[model samples]
Target: MFINSKGYYIPTKRVDNNYFAKLNDLSEDWYFKRTGILTRARASEEETINYMSIKAVENAIKNLPYDIHEVDLIVFASYTPNDTVGTTAHIIQKEFNINNAKAFYISSACSSAINGMEIINSFFKSKISSKALLICADRNSSYSDDRDTQSGHLWGDAAVALFFSSEPIRPNEASILDINTLGLGNVGHGPQAVTMEPKNGLHMPYGKDVFTHACVYLARLTDTIIKKNGYSISDLTYFIGHQANKRILNNVCHELGLAENKSLSNVEELGNTGCASAPLVFAQNYDIFKEGDLVCLSVFGGGYSCGTCLIKFN
Candidate 1:
């Protein structure tokens, strides 16, 4: 089963390039031409991660043919949670009345959902759970500093969910081939602090360095995964990358010798939805997928973490 992304929302107001020009010596054309991003969605102050997750899951459930109660596990992945003390999975479970399933959460920066998929695959293989529902949601806008153009212009809000079942009751068109992860603790040091100051709020990211590392690591790791899986670049139908920046995506495509259209990007429409970005792209384009088509997904973000996975559509 594949998790479908639904109920997409983004902010309407476009922060002009003048904002960046004054703050960071950057321009709108620089962001747009470079990242293929013109705007991103921002959740309202009244909206919380849990609320968005609930709405997204509700939409996904409505689109599904099966009952929600059939799910045996619930896995919610996000770096931004409604609270620090409790797992958001239970809240979703209660909302859906999925009392029989086990609920938990995982955090690996922007790669959380893909990492969650790795774990869900293991659980099903071990017979620990027959089915799992994975949801990736984030509200970066809530943590962003409006005055920091680099980070403000880049961050967006979204929620996406996927359902997985172990039983071969119905043959799936696509199957996960492999998922691999490499932590950049020794290099990027991960997110050491998360603070919202009284005036500026969140700290601004070092855009140049982050973009450099993302392109370099993703290109190398993507090559490694394709080769290790005994597959070539020609085997992939699409390479869905994290919608962090247009330049990074273009650079990775160039490095891999892949065509521009081979990548599915929603950065311009949704900005950086963190872990939700890749799957959201898949969900939006799922209808066009056919059997034997190969899809490669790569993500690199805040944890200074990077991951790549291969999927074959039935």
Candidate 2:
């Protein structure tokens, strides 16, 4: 598997600490201390989801043994797409000139990329495809309002691409073991179901309530997956959680009996990249991973979706 991230492109607006002080909110020091984020990347108006996705995929394919056309399938995951009908996968395929590859898109909020991983694993195991490209890109900054400090400060835009192949290679570092997912409440019948609102755009979460549910479900599900995989908590060297909030992550880590540093976080630096957060962490820290090291990735977010996966680098 090959993982890569792109776009540390800066944003235009530069909000200061005093501006936040007037809102009676936490200071910059408090925010950075709590979330470990000093700054986040924001895309410019000229940068669209397609542009970022293409750049990310280009970076991911570099230095690989096979050419881009060798990829038999592409699984693109994102909640924010350039258009509702246009598949970003097709756009990427066209950009890379990988005409032989089949393309599909996944739309599961923040856990979308993890969901893509599961899908790629199934394809490889089932003999449907040998090589699959999983690209996750999101432009969450577009939906955010600078005036709404609460939501605006919690988002960033990014694109990440990962390549997974079934062919067994030498120096196996980490390979995907298994994945498990749980969605809260009924898909179409939940109180927290996504609904379109005229003025509000889209509505579902009520802030604190979502935080409570995320903490409880994420903690329970993560523990269950770790145990079910026949691996003890100590076996995992790293716990990569979705970059949502410091409080939620801290609560989950506390419940899991894991150290704070063991859980790789980028919320402070990248805010929330939606679907790109988890893989972005791997891409940024790929150099730190060694052969046989096991990394557990847990993703939880907006679709009321939660996922857990164990990967061993080669």
Q: Highest TM-score: which candidate?
A: 1
lDDT of 1 by residue, 16-124 (tens): 4456556777666776775576767778766688888887787677666577888889999887777755777988898889978989988888878788888888898
In candidate 1, clashing pairs total 8
Candidate 1's error at 204, in angstroms?
4.4
TM-score of 2: 0.87
CA lDDT scores, all candidates in order: 0.77, 0.73
* TM-score of each model, paired residue for residue: 0.88, 0.87
RMSD (Å) per prediction: 2.9, 3.3
Off by over 4 Å in 1: 1-27, 188-201
